[model samples]
Target chain A: MAFNTGAALMDALVLSVVSNESTYGYKITQDVRSVMDVSESSLYPVLRRLQKDGCLETYDREFAGRNRRYYSITEKGVDQLEDYRVQWREYAEKVDRVLFGGIDDDKN
Target chain B: MTKTEFLSRLAEELKGISAEEREEALNYYSEYLDEAGEENEEAAIEELGGPEKVARIIRANTAQSAQGAQPAAPKAAAEDPFGAAAQPVPPSSAYAQGGQSAQQAQSGPAYTQSGPDDTQSGPAYAQTAPGAPHIPYEGYEAPRRRSYLWLWIILGVICIPVIIGLLGAILGLIGGVIGMLASLIIGGATAAFAGFGLIIKSVFLFSSYPAGALFMMGGGFLTGGLGVLACAFGIWLIRKGVPFVASSIRSGWSYLKGKVRDLRWND
Candidate 1:
């Protein structure tokens, strides 16, 4: 819960949110905020970078009489997300083993 | 703080960012506040933190990401994202929005008011609302068009006269060679005519006056020798001048061919 959000992690989070459905900036930020303590402003730059990297695509839609830009995940973004997930699983498993190893030993 | 004040401050803080980025940020926050509704405006603003802090975070993130992607983007983004001076914004990553807007934005005003309809709303709702004038992010100036134009003009002015002078020299040398050949032909023909006439005259006079015939024969031989010298001079001129003209023509053709190749390559 208390960890820095590196670029890869941030990319993964944004891609995951966008992978579900095409979402706007604020909504994406809200969804991301549900899991992490991130500044709303920080999310915009991440979204922009992902879009720049071809991991995300944006389109404008009329919502409540105003144009809201929505971001959708690209095929490239899905691939990137898969890579991130694999890496995260490997990383988390290694860390979990070390951090929870003692408890398992005591139980055994 | 009210939403309008908050956004304007954020825009002010984001002065040096590209216009598209500035609009995207502004639109996102404005929509966020609108969704929060009037009752929660102040709370939403507090939750988002100060515009300055938010701007700093945004700028730092963009600069870092740009640095990762391109060698040039980071330099411009890092040098002064907040400075009043305008800087060129690199094209977004291949997947981002249309790159045309960034190019167009640099040529025109950085910010254009969206429209007048939204301003009629409450002050908090004014500016950057669905209908408000788009406050364009300022700070990027396109490269100077006039300077490049002037550079081309200067190069033309310097190069044209030299090319013309080279052409004139080549033509003049060809003309001089032709004139020399014409004079050689005329001189040889006149000497031959005179030598033959003197020889015939000496043969006719030999029976009547032997001393006078001897003088005419000597004169004929001298005239014949002069004609032979003229013929030798013409041959020498042909030997030297033909190669010189041929080489000059070849060099000029090669020079022109090289220039054409260069132009094609440049194109």
Candidate 2:
């Protein structure tokens, strides 16, 4: 509900996508939407940021009726994602262990 | 809210927000709407909480990221928290709307509450988040206000001659002496030449040149009035806000150009 959650969620979602091959803009937006709620406008800047930071590489690809830019994950992006995964695993494990011992094994 | 109104209002609220933020919020709402089966204004507003709140959340996260601080990541959220039965339904995670791998969803470091790169020697949070650059207002100085004293000075200068000319026409002899003295001091040797011309002509051709005499008298008065006008103008210029005439004119021209530009921009 806090403001940061929205952005954190977006970052999580974006990192989710870039972990694979490069993706274009519209597709990323769609992918984010498939799992959560988001607008095309919001996704645009995030994609731009990822590209700017060199975490992802973006190129244009024509889709539907227009050219949609796809963002592909970079080595740096992968490294970043791995670092996040490590942190996440630790946190999630802690939360799980606190709430329901050994239950963490069931969800993942 | 109908889809169009929702989109429009959302657009207006998101006006200055970064593109990434707008997209993220919209995507979140759209997914909520699709799943919740709610389309009314209240529902939309409730889901979004409040425009500013949503914006602030987005802004804070972005501001932090811009500052380069990220939080600890959690274990990857299950792709299908509801299990395989709901899997065919796309799990409807706003984020997973497109078929992306779990690894991709796990992408990027978990965001931290702290701002960007504070560990470095430089100032913490100095870096703006990617895509949103911080622009300082100091960089854009307001156009300087032009002084209006120049206008008053010019008007005053123009008025002096008219006043002196009227006085000269009223009391010819007395006005002639006053005009001669004023002109002598103000106009220097030129005033002496005109005075001598008046005197010589008056003696030589009093009756036959009465008309010429009157014309010469009018001419002398005009010259004296002009001298008065110049002195008045110089004094006005000194009293006015403008330090000098040239500067005033320059400011006036620039102000005029500025107004024109404003009109053009408005158009």
Candidate 3:
């Protein structure tokens, strides 16, 4: 589904993706693209923002004779992810209730 | 585009970002392309979109996070959230959005916003605030006006002597020519008159006329002295006229030299 992801949501998504395991930029972009129709270019800024906010950390590793940068989620990032989950649950339910009849109710 | 071309374009697009942040961003993107593999470079670039849009996202993200970090200091946050966190970013994005000239014009306001505290200080704030009538006090123009007066004085001093000298030289040249012509005419006439008187005196003496010879001799002597006196006066005119012309020329040259020296000193 196509959706305009807000900054908070983008940050949360990046943090959650990295929280799974430390991953390189291309892999993270591919993972995020599975759910959202965001340009790969848009992910870098979100990654930078999460890093700046202490929710992410980065390190360089060599693979195939070239340097590759990997991003990992920090404790702060996990905390931020928890907050985003709670907020997203409430927000999604509200948006779903308005768009559809009710998120869990039967529809005819 | 090739990886090199894409990275360079991205770097060019991110003009206002700090060196360290820009390096990090570039490193991230470079590694991203590398991870995409050589064969997928083109596809990766196409998926990322243009460098300009990417730069905008990065700049916006940096600005937003900076604001988030310091929520308490509203004043500093308002002054320049982007510049305070990252190195000052010039309004190059305006160029990316518009064109070169438009970006140049926008840079001024962007700088004013990101400039030193003096620009945001109380006095400047009051003067620039909307709906405030700007009234310059009496002393406001003092320094600049006084400098203008000094400039005029120096220019006048340098120019007046040259003007006067030029006028004098022109007048002196004309007067000297006229004086030389007049002196030539007067000297020739007196000399002719003296020669005639001498000839008459010689004729009277040869003819044995005592009284007439004496009268002619007296007239001849008197005419000879008058011719000599006229010649002397002409010589005097030549001497005085030449000096007057020379002095005027010398004065004009000295004034010109002085003007050159003053210009050099000012430089």
Candidate 4:
């Protein structure tokens, strides 16, 4: 939680959340906050940028009397999320090798 | 402390960014606070770390992303697709199932009813046209969709003389400036031409009259160097002078036009 979550991880985190459920801004912040020590305010711009990137598309659904803007992942977003997953796996493995030094071999 | 104070402070910090962007940010935060509800409003505001901090984050993100990258799914994101389609049915999927439709955040802000719709109208972008996203904020309105056609048409009908006068004045100004620079351009060109001519003559005379040719060559170099300098200066003058002269004429023309208009009004 103390380490910096880079933009890519943030995107992955957001995409994974939205990919699970087409949620609104407040809910997305809450969900992201649940997993990581991130501010609720910072996520708006990320959501906006992701939406601009064609990685996310939004639709307004009337909630009670007011409309809540809901973000849903596009095909592009799904592909991006998959890319992020592969990259994250490779990254984590590399970091682990350097930090833990053949600990897998020792355990085995 | 309250949502209104928090939002206005945020808006002030965000004046530099585009209006559409600012409105969307404000609306998002407003709805965000609304979602937090009455009981938890103070905690929500605290969690957001004050509006000033929120605005700074947004501003930094905005500046970072504005470098030539355009929004990709424009029609999808730019317009309210659900509203535009007029399809009351939601874009139902597995994603929709878990969350269900999010309820409206207007439970009660206490000031909701008495507040002007303009002031408290949550993030609802009034789609004024098919493409233009109009946020119903007091300070920002969608740019007026009006053509200056009548003004142009009247000018076309009655201001033929005025147009001619402007053209004539511009031309006369250009001609006078060119006339001033004409001396230098011609002088430089003439000297350059004569210097080249002498250098060629020196080449021809080197075979027949060596001493005379040497003297001619020395003279040629002297004249040639001065000619080139004058020519460079003249061209520089023309380049700098023309725009200066033209702008002056434009200002003078406008001043005269204003005076004439004043006279007509007084009469």
Candidate 5:
């Protein structure tokens, strides 16, 4: 029943992928599925939220026999993603430190 | 079965599901058709589940996903499919399942899919097709909502000088304390009497000449009053909303130009 795990992380990851170049919906969905456990339910909302916040822009491209929506990063989006990345990295490190204990001294 | 047929049936089956879920189910079924080959509806359907059983599973999964997303809704509200606040979940299979929050935090929450029926209550947005036509941001030109505090601050700023002037008048009535003390201490009876008389005369003059007294009280009151008025006017201008601000900003720019012209001419 606990569905919040890695949910926010997925949005951050999606932003990272879209930040690089224009990507279609299917590709983004597939990419998330390949690495981590992202429900299709989560991706749509994240995309909508990002668009609403002016972080990303979308256009349509012909794919297969139909037109598919393609998402691209905006300057605003890049800035937001950078902010998220900074926060996420710090958070990840802190989590790692606490969960694994002793800061994984091997990296040092 | 053809990909189109398979997708059509999947869509039909997932009618109560969110657009995201529906699209996902279609995509998944399409992928299955591609992988498992055509002429295998029975096999694919079997693999997924019988239509009724699949519907039940989809319902259960969607409910679970929705519950996962929105912890705030009541159990009755939770069960209401097509309620505008809950997420229209299809099944966990529609996406990678189970990455929900460990503890549902109140802030920075995700959007829960609400069905159409309850859309009026909560913030409801449709799962738009990726290439859906963009509805023009109609109110983009409209002004934003602002706090009423700015108006109050402007009014308070304007009142300061008036308050100071009133205090000054009260002191003038009380033998101009500084003048009375100085005259009595420095020059004894004669000076003190003169100072007291002068204070009485000033009070009488102020009582007779309200306008002159106010003017003598100086520009503080005027400045404060104008400041307050300007703030009130500013709030009024802003209250007309963003479109008003946009137009007024242009006018204000021209006013600035005219003021600059006046300043140059005066110089």
Candidate 6:
């Protein structure tokens, strides 16, 4: 894509992924990368940032006789996601207006 | 390389961070590799861009949390992150380890030797002390992301108020100077009017007392001349004042507009 996703967008995507179900680091990265061109190793810092900011929490879940760290969205993370959605909606609408200024049949 | 080699190198690269952070990072990476299973382990490692890059990312986060004054995580991160002091390590993540580097890693042994509670994965753990003091690096580039845009936005947001306050102060100062000049012009006019009145009085006194009339005339001319000079000076200042104030406001507005452009919101 020509456009680069900003930090807010990335944060929103990560939070959204975890919001659906508690998952592990590898899964989160894979899901996020499926949509955007993000580096595989990039999600760790984002996870750590959100974790410290109290947006996400991690816990150990046993799988195949090994512990896999699972991350679940917190209340703060949900609120942050909501905020991102609102802002993104507004942003997308504005961009659409500028790009499709002559699409006169559009209704709000 | 195998997951063990990747993780051991990563642990080595993250040698300076807090033990708590290091151990968590190791567990996370180790789990990541295991989750990939034997078949995709090489691909996973390759996707990670090797352990060096992963270690760099972890270290960068550690620095950021250290200086950011974040709770439970010591403060740090700018372009460079701070190395948080050794947080008390928890031994829980160390469970269910393979026969990886459980015995031969040097850094892990040093850490476990000092740690009252050590875990099983030797190579995965980085050396850290309980009270390890934070050493913040200056201007360390943040993680490889587009977050610098966000940082710039934040910085602009913080500086906006300060810039406005300074602009207000400068405008006020210019307004005060202009105000004083206006008053001076009025005062000069008043003095000139008084001097004219004195001169007319002197004319009236000329017939009755020549000496007194002469003295009054001399005083009137001196006062009139000083008043005119003051008036001229005030006018000159006012003439210069308009462009000076306008340019100041223009520059301030220009700077403010540039800042706003960078921080353009949807609203």
Off by over 4 Å in 4: A103-108, B69-267
Give the total clashing residue pairs for model 4. Answer: 1
- Expressed as tens digits, the lDDT of each residue in B218-249 for candidate 5 is 44444444444544554554456457757977
Q: What Cα-based lDDT does every candidate model obtain?
A: 0.64, 0.49, 0.62, 0.66, 0.49, 0.67
Q: Write the per-residue lDDT of candidate 5 for residues A1-108, one digit (tens) a residue.
A: 223233345556788889877886556766866765433334554565567558878886565565566789999888766766776666667657766975556555
Error of 3 at B95 (Å): 33
- TM-score of each prediction: 0.46, 0.32, 0.45, 0.48, 0.34, 0.47
Tens digit per residue, CA lDDT, model 4, A1-108: 213233456667899999998999899988987876555666887799898889999998888777788999999999988877876776687667866887775676
iRMSD, model 3, in Å: 13.1
TM-score of each model's chain B: 0.38, 0.25, 0.31, 0.31, 0.24, 0.44
The runs of at least 3 residues in candidate 3 whose Cα sits more than 4 Å from the true structure, single-residue gaps closed, are A102-108, B65-267
DockQ of 3: 0.13
What are the per-residue Cα lDDT tens digits for candidate 3 across A1-73? 2122333555567788999899988999889877765567767766776777688998988888888878999
lDDT of 6 at B23: 90
Model 5 stretches astray by more than 4 angstroms: A1-4, A40-42, A100-108, B13-267
Residues B1-267, candidate 3: write the lDDT tens digits.
Answer: 888998898899777667887898888888888888899998877766556555655654454334332233223322322221222225445325334334323222221121222121111111111222222221122344456669978999999989899999989988878777577658756775876778676675957887777777777777777776667776677789779978998999999999977865454
| Tens digit of per-residue lDDT, candidate 4, span B1-267 | 888899999999899889999998998888888888878988888877677667766765565445322232234223332122222223443124332222112111111111122223222222222343333222222121112345557779798998899999979987886776787778877898888889889999998999999999988887887888788888999789778878997999999999977854443
* lDDT (Cα, 0-100) at B16 in candidate 3: 66
Greater-lDDT candidate between 2 and 4: 4
Rate residue B125 of model 5 by lDDT: 22
Candidate 1 residue-wise lDDT, B89-110, digit = tens: 4445312346534532442211
Q: Name model 2 segments beyond 4 Å from true.
A: A1-6, A37-41, A102-108, B1-267
User: Per-residue CA lDDT of candidate 6, range B59-150, in tens?
Assistant: 75566555542332222121111111122323333222432123223223321121212323221222222332232332133332236567
